[model samples]
Target: MSVDRSYIRVKAMLVSPNDDGSRHLVSRNAPTSENPLGFHRLIGGSVELGETHQEAIIREVHEELGARILDLTHLGMVESIFRYNGELGHEIVALYSGRLEPAPADEGGTLTESDGSVVPVVWRPFDDADITVPLYPAGARNWIRSSLT
Candidate 1:
């Protein structure tokens, strides 16, 4: 079994407006069949050898959420070690918090769920993040908390 010695990853904040000063988070579900790392909550993926972290995040946001990223700012890096179904990998995930362009309407781009099925974009109240269905990565919560402040 070959393993990737090193890899870079990115995650988008995907923020929307709320009546209050706080913002809502646009999240999705990871396709359980295709992705085991719970990657659905944020729009991101691995950065290729020649691709920059920002490029990858922007590309993924368009691909997954079907919305253009107006702004993407780095939220520092988090050391993530993931073990899925016996496969182990480590990532230097560059977390980012950004606002979506066009102010996500009721309908958004096609995003895959944990079962490898497509799910529509969802607007989640930041305060009620915990009760939402489908689990998210620890780094995502951390970034949101820090970014909002």
Candidate 2:
């Protein structure tokens, strides 16, 4: 069998420290037919042609969460292999660490995906989240924690 080519996915991740000094994260899981096992994931997407990883992350976070990333930092990339809908998948994931600038209280934010899927976005403490849902790429939690330190 021929091996699958690498698919690149650019992700924008934010760990925001609230006034109480506790860090909260923004995550979502838009269920698609192709993704049989549903789980919440980081806010990110594919890097389009001619666009750089930084550009894609910025665009994705804005398009998906309607939030802007501030003091963005490149935390490096993580590569992994997995399966979706019984098909093997390989991804070169560009992971970014950043903080979300406070959104205006007047407007509620939303997510816009390529498939027109709407997933729930939730913010919770780092420790409180890992138990509730399985995060993709496995290394995301570590990176998120490292961002705040």
Candidate 3:
């Protein structure tokens, strides 16, 4: 069965903070024309058919990072409308907060996507100044910032 790229997608993502809550895990994306410097986003993926957003988040984290999420808490939702590569895309994202079990190293690591492409994963401080690579789903970033204060 093929999925429609133009249709708005429903996704579940996690805001996984490190032990001290000073940093969060993010996946670095390749540079696109819309964002020449590229960008970073929280780890998680699409909510599959018949899956709850919470269940989707757990499955996605395990699949994307081979890690488990604990103490999951519903953060909120955000609508993302943007372009990737050259195609317009839209997503309604359900966000959650949690901690990663066996967190990735401070030096960061790589994670393979469902498409088998490997991307770098890193722990970034909330105050990171590289605005060129802003955290995506702008609303998600705002939520994280508000929670940190």
Candidate 4:
């Protein structure tokens, strides 16, 4: 058996403002992650074969957040070289920002993985991301922060 390596991947940052008038970023707890941390811990994933980056984002939102994005504007591309568990990994991930049309009406309060994995999504202000979540691809965190400018 051979390892399946993905040289390319795509994702989206579906964000919204909380009732307290603070912004929150969203991310999906990856299937491989056993314990995922904070808000950027909301919804996202890789682009499937023949699927465009935008399509993957849409699919991810539906599957993870149960919410459709009214619009997704390209934020930027993030090239990342990082190590996880001591293994070096590199990726050029396409990043985009979308406005959630409305709070997801799904009965579940937290996002669920399609594979039956469940991790709670805890919303935190942008300023709190560092203290709360362990965002991957370091560049993505920077892109998200810069896009708000």
Candidate 5:
């Protein structure tokens, strides 16, 4: 059985600075994390019924990590046609670059799902966070490499 979901979403890739001023990205580890395991996801979800892209991003960050997102500078958008969890999925993703305000670090933030699973909010090293990983999207990867110079 192949499940199909076609929708639009907003992604907030938070650039958090280390004590030395180098930046790292915050992400969520996928439930099905495997192989290389333990990577943060692009922080966003479905745009919801009537929310604007910006609103959606903020809401997603808050819900997922309980952190208030700020300075959401729009990156770009992509038409992603891909397969997810053995299913076909398509998403129009609007990207944003920003930081978390009063954001938890040192492995502080976490999400408790309805099933009582704890999802860790990870601060992924910048170099390690690329398209080669399972979570980072190709579109954002290209934009990050080309535009964020």
Candidate 6:
């Protein structure tokens, strides 16, 4: 199905922490015209028409990483308005906190997208360097910090 880029999209995302909660799982995003350096984002995807945000998160995690989420909790919501690949995109993201079952390797790994493209997944410290590629949706880091605390 072709997405209507002109309309705001709704997504459900999961912020899954490691065993010690020192780092979280994120997938590396490819460099777009708006982000030449690329970035990292939480795991999850769009909420299907009949599915709840919670259901969407679980389904997305399973699809992307072949894992299940435990202790799922609604964190908060974030509105993301940004440009990607030269196109302006808007989204209302529902953020959820949880743990991944059979957690990803400590050293990091890769996730295969629905489109058949593979992207690296890594455990990144919360306070990574400011100069490094940023986490998308701007205030996502803040929500993650609050959920962990």
Model 6 agreement with the true structure over 1-149: per-residue lDDT tens digits: 24568989999988888999888888888797877889888888899899998889988999989999889999889999987777788999999989999899987588877777888998878766654887876778789766684
Which of 2 and 3 is ahead in lDDT?
Answer: 3
Query: Using lDDT as the measure, what is the rank order of every candidate, best first?
Result: 3, 6, 2, 5, 4, 1
Candidate 1 residues 70-102, lDDT tens each? 556777776666654455556666677677665
TM-score of each: 0.64, 0.72, 0.92, 0.70, 0.71, 0.92
lDDT by residue for model 4 over 37-113, one digit each (tens)?
42244356667788887788788877876777765777767776754434455666667766665664333357666
Residue pairs in steric clash, candidate 6? Answer: none
Residue 80 shift from truth in candidate 4, angstroms:
2.4
Query: What is candidate 1's TM-score against the reference?
Result: 0.64
The TM-score measured for candidate 4 stands at: 0.70
- In order, the Cα lDDT scores of the candidates are 0.57, 0.63, 0.85, 0.58, 0.59, 0.85
Candidate 2 vs candidate 4: the lDDT winner is 2
lDDT of 2 by residue, 68-118 (tens): 888787887777576655666766677776677654222233467767676
RMSD of 2: 4.8
Model 2 TM-score, 2 decimals: 0.72
Candidate 3 local lDDT, 1-149, one digit each (tens): 23466899999988888888888989998788888888898899899899999999999988888999888899899999877777888999999998988788887587778888888998878877655587877778888888753
Candidate 6 stretches with Cα past 4 Å from truth are: 1-4, 129-131
Evaluation by lDDT, superior candidate among 1 and 5: 5
lDDT tens digits by residue: candidate 5, 1-149: 22237544433343444444444455566544142554455666667677788887778777766777666688778666655555566677887767776666767767543344677666555555453445455456576555543
lDDT of 5 at 132: 47
TM-score of 6: 0.92
